[model samples]
Target: MIKQMPFVETDRLYLRGLEEEDVCDIYAYLSMEETREFLDLEQQQNIDQTWNLLYEEYLPYIEKSLFQCWVMEQKQSGKVIGHLRLYEEQQCLFVEMLLHPAYWKQGYMKEALMKMLQHVYTFLKHQNVYVKVRKENKNCIFLLESLGFQYITCVKEMLSNGKMYNMWIERLSEKEWRKQNEKNT
Candidate 1:
């Protein structure tokens, strides 16, 4: 399949293709205690561990699958602050994002997420977008809810790291997105 690269521009951030160089930036958050607290994996202890996860695991799976990652960069400093992954699974487009703690509460993630939601609606024409978050990830839950995603149900799954998670699945339908956009306009 031919890849159609996505270049999404938001007011405060730019969503561009994620490269291998971004592994370090991604590890900045993945290595943190607070960020990993709700995540299924233990906090990364070294760069090698992060590299293995990103290179040996995720990269291969993403390469063969209908998935792409966008690294969020600050337009002013050109610093990578986070990354997001969009993939198709079970007939739904799924979006997952992670942001550095230093940049949290600044709305960058929200900006990137909004842009991708529009892309899914416009380009992918997906009926719904789904996201699964740990129930304890209050910040993520709040962000999803604020974006008009409805709580679908709770599910439990075992992570690759041998940990189990109680997650809340949420979804934003095309109808719901259209409704939200109508209100905004």
Candidate 2:
């Protein structure tokens, strides 16, 4: 089994490996119609289904070292607000993030993402980290672009749901990240 990763802290938030206690918070989002729109869930009827999915589907991926999920909590309020995942596939790291709808537009996600990117690049030594955002998620697209990610292409018939969505890929080399940081100093 893969060793459990440690908690990561940012300026305003803390990210730690998901625990069984997080089922309720996760279910709150997973069961929401608005949040499920871009996600792959067919439907979540009850807490038992959510619990099974979290344990059976998601936990196994974590145990196999194929994916890692982190629960995002506000440092000040100690409230669980969202989740972020790093998926290892085809020798690449794919990032997936979701925030509570109530916390949208507060810059919390950018803070969490910035910290995650740093950890993935500097600590994990992963050179190529990518994210796939829906074509209509303009807010997320703009956020990624502002973080130095460039537009790659739109993927057609990319999802199993028979929906064609835009796919934007970004690569951050260690050298590039260092140079970018130097400029900010």
Candidate 3:
């Protein structure tokens, strides 16, 4: 249902496709234990794993337009600070994001997501955008809630990684997102 990931820009960041050079920066956060705490992924063991994930997995998927993976690049530093993945299934659009710990609580993610949400609701014409967060991920829950995402329900299931956890399903309707955007502006 989705096609190419278009490049998006905000005042402080650019959301663009992934590149080989981003592997090291991606590894920097993916390898951290704290970073993986609320995520379903295991802590990345080494740089090669991140390389394989980007080259063998992410790049091919992006090329085929299977899913959209965006690299969040800081405009001032021109450095990759995070990554975002978006996909649709069964008529529901889902979004996932990760930012380096060094940039945490800096409002960079909020900026990136606002741009992405605008694209999702406006250009894509999706009625609603959804995100699933582990229940214990208070920071993520707060962020999504602040963006007008409403709590849907909670699910307890085994993830692909063979881990079981309580996951909260949250959604933001286009109308509500537009309302929130209008308030922000």
- Cα-based lDDT for every prediction: 0.81, 0.75, 0.87
Q: Write the per-residue lDDT of candidate 2 for residues 1-185, one digit (tens) a residue.
A: 24344588988889888878888777877777877666656567788888898788567664565566778988998877898888866676788888878788898888888777787777787776777777677888888766766666667545667766665565555666666657645
Best-performing candidate as measured by TM-score:
3
By summed lDDT, which 10 consecutive residues of candidate 3 come out lowest? 59-68
Give the candidates in order of TM-score, highest first: 3, 1, 2
The order by descending lDDT is 3, 1, 2
Task: List the candidate 2 regions with Cα displacement exceeding 4 Å.
Answer: 1-4, 158-160, 182-185
RMSD score of candidate 1 (Å): 2.2
Residue 148, model 2: lDDT of 66
Worst 10 residues of 2 by lDDT: 1-10
Q: Candidate 3, residues 49-164: lDDT per residue as tens digits? A: 88887776578874766675889999998889898888776778899889988898899989999988888877888899999899999999999999999999998979878878
TM-score of 1: 0.88
**Candidate 1, which ten residues in sequence have the lowest lDDT sum?**
57-66
What does candidate 1's lDDT look like per residue over 16-73, in tens digits? 8877887887788889987666666667888888888777645665467646677898
